[model samples]
Target: MSSPHIIVVPLPIAGHVNPLVQFSAKLVKNGMRVSFIVADYYYNRVMSAIAAEIQGEEDCHVGLQSQVKLHSIPDGLGPEDDKNDMPKLFLSTSASWPAMLEKIIQEINGSDREGKVTAMIADLHMGWALEVADKMGIKGSIFWPSSAAFLAVEFSIPNLIDQKVIDNDGVPIGRQTFQLSPSMIRMDTEHLPWNLNNDLVTRKKVFDFFFNIGRALKLTNWWLCNTSSELEPAALTLLPNLVPIGPLMTPYKKASRQHLSEEGLSCLNWLDQQPARSVIYVAFGSLTFVEYKQFQELALGLELTRKPYLWVVPSSVITSTKFSNIYPDGFNNSLRKIVGWAPQQMVLSHPTIACFVTHCGWNSIVEGLCNGVPLLCWPFVAEQFYAKTYVSDVWKIGLAFESCENGIVSGGEIKNKLEQLVSNEDMRERCSKLGEMTMKSIQGDGQSSNNISKFIQWLKE
Candidate 1:
């Protein structure tokens, strides 16, 4: 039998693209031919990372090339010429998706490749892929790229609204606290992540998107998540045909440039001198921003914990000249060291790293779990709150801190949670066990591997 040919489409973002790249590599290992269709702007970075990873593999060759497939789509809003303007960028991308899909399908159909385009795998955020696949008569699967438990919460939003547990606007409509299904974690309007409350229109748009996703469930050939059933079995039951294939990472033994930032190596060397399980690794995923005051508080908290640590403080967070004063008294000189960028996977996989003080981004959560590092979850926005719920409540592998009255979490609270996660032996033991399970699920003969194979087979048929 000939190997199946698949085209994996990823949203043009670092967090989204990296996992799809890993998944594509896994498909190649399983004897499939793969092509990645990515935005022109991100083409070079994505291909470079993939090329670095596959440098020595003899039989497995992963092909990557750029196509101007989605340039015409308008994101219901005007064109966002500036890449740095995040709000306009996201809106423009979302609006442009429908037009982009039409162009991509045209390109694929006209290609000289022998086999017909058999299947389409898309990111949930790029919801237009379903429509494109339907028009092309190709099987379509939506990859949640998050925990099964988090996806379960998203799928349950309509039901929650129907029960008046959440308002039509996705705000908690009633005062009585109610838990969302599958994961069984409590939900409160005030506890939602930052995106839920920043603006009414934005919140509504997000809510409507999820609601549409829920309604389109059956049209989806399958749902794929970057999690294993062992980590979220209860949540898996909520969706009949869900595939969990991840903690997808660059191969542990391979020397890949995918994680090699300029400062990454230096950061790892610094971590080497810290005592085993004594360093807290702090990072927010790609899009989150930290205010100067909050950044200072976090620095102070780490200092108070008195643990050697590595922090990925983005340049934007330290732009203010007064940024140094944001930390606790004398913290800048008191701690071991701080760096602007860190080799995240290296730090998490290191023996000296005790816990992750994270913004609870899905990719970071999966990486932390794969390395068996416990987490102190402070979810800033987006699906982070859902990820936090899975880590703290469902998995019992981590803890969450209270957000302030204004829904902002302060450095003092961050300090308290970091101390608790590192000092508590029981939390450590549970995280270690969960981490082991997470690793096993992604290895040979594991449930995640098996399920991914099955999902591919279904796609072929």
Candidate 2:
């Protein structure tokens, strides 16, 4: 019989796309054929990522590449659409994507030689795909690429409404603390993912987008998350449908020396010469926009640490006219390296990385924790605050930064946090212990490994 075929989709962004692509690789490895689809706008980037990941797999597994097909559908966006504006991009795609995806699935199903698609696994952000999967009589699942704790909060929206913590529109009714269960950590109202946006209009639009995601989630036959039971015991227990079958990072990916760009290779080479546990790795994700003054403060702050640092500054900063001229007066290039991009999984796996100074994005949190690197959390917006809460408060593996009244994290504050993070033996030990447990979760007989086996069996059955 032909192997079961699965369709996979992801929101067109680095964090979202990377994991689902890796997950596609996993599906292919388990004797399933996969149709990996993306918006035309991100096709090239996604293809590049897939190629990089493939380069690291074993020779025996090389043939698996042929099993995972790549397909693209136009997002109905034009040249004039500002793809960088996430809310607008999501709102636009909501109108255009469902029909586009439906057409793609029809083509796949109609193919004479290809195996019929038995299921679809998509990023939760693209939840509407689940509805489409239902229409086609295929099993539908949504992958939560972030923390299960984050998923728990989103899944509990109805409960939040009943408790009057949030209104029907998903806006906070007051400054209140919420917990999916009493055993879980309480999160603040202001830090709720949708409430972080200062503009009410934008906030409502973002909330409504997620609200629609919640509606579509009802159609899911399986709700998979890129996390482990070891990391979020309470949240997983609370949401029984939330299966923890990840770190979704492939083992080949964890150990791969492959680079996405020349700049990334250069960053790894520089780390090679640094002392053990001495380099501070800093990367705010693709979506973070650092202001010019804050950028200056960060540069100065890394300098203040008097420790070697490697910072990944994304391409979005290229438009900042003053970005090039913001380094400290005595900034030594030998000790401070900035790259346009860095192969993050490789960088985190390096021996020289002492701690990560991060924006607390869920992907970053997972990578840092799995690598046993301590963190100095500097959250910019959205669910990052909740992620930081877990990092600093629940897991006790990291520390949070306090911004000044002006919202700039001063150089001194950064330096102090670095010192505190590095010097705390207890935190370092906790980080190491948690990292071991997390990495083990994906290995043989681990919780995540067992879950993945069960999921594959279900798909085949």
Q: What is the C-alpha RMSD of each candidate to the true structure, in Å?
A: 4.0, 2.2
Predicted structure 1, TM vs. truth: 0.84
Question: Which stretches of candidate 2 lie above 4 Å from their native place?
Answer: 55-60, 78-80, 252-259, 321-324, 328-330
For candidate 1, the 10 contiguous residues with the lowest summed lDDT are 64-73
Evaluate residue 374 in candidate 2 and report its C-alpha lDDT on the 0 to 100 scale: 96
Q: How accurate is candidate 1 locally (lDDT)?
A: 0.69
lDDT of 2 by residue, 268-382 (tens): 8999999999999999988888887888788888888888999988766866455466555776756988887888888888899999999998889988988889998988776
Winning model by TM-score:
2
Task: Give lDDT per model, in order.
Answer: 0.69, 0.82
Error of 1 at 67 (Å): 14
What tens-digit string does per-residue lDDT give for candidate 1 at 170-195? 77664665566534566555654324
Alpha-carbon error at 389 in model 2, in Å? 0.9
Runs in model 1 deviating more than 4 A are: 1-3, 39-41, 52-91, 113-116, 191-197, 214-216, 251-259, 320-331, 402-417
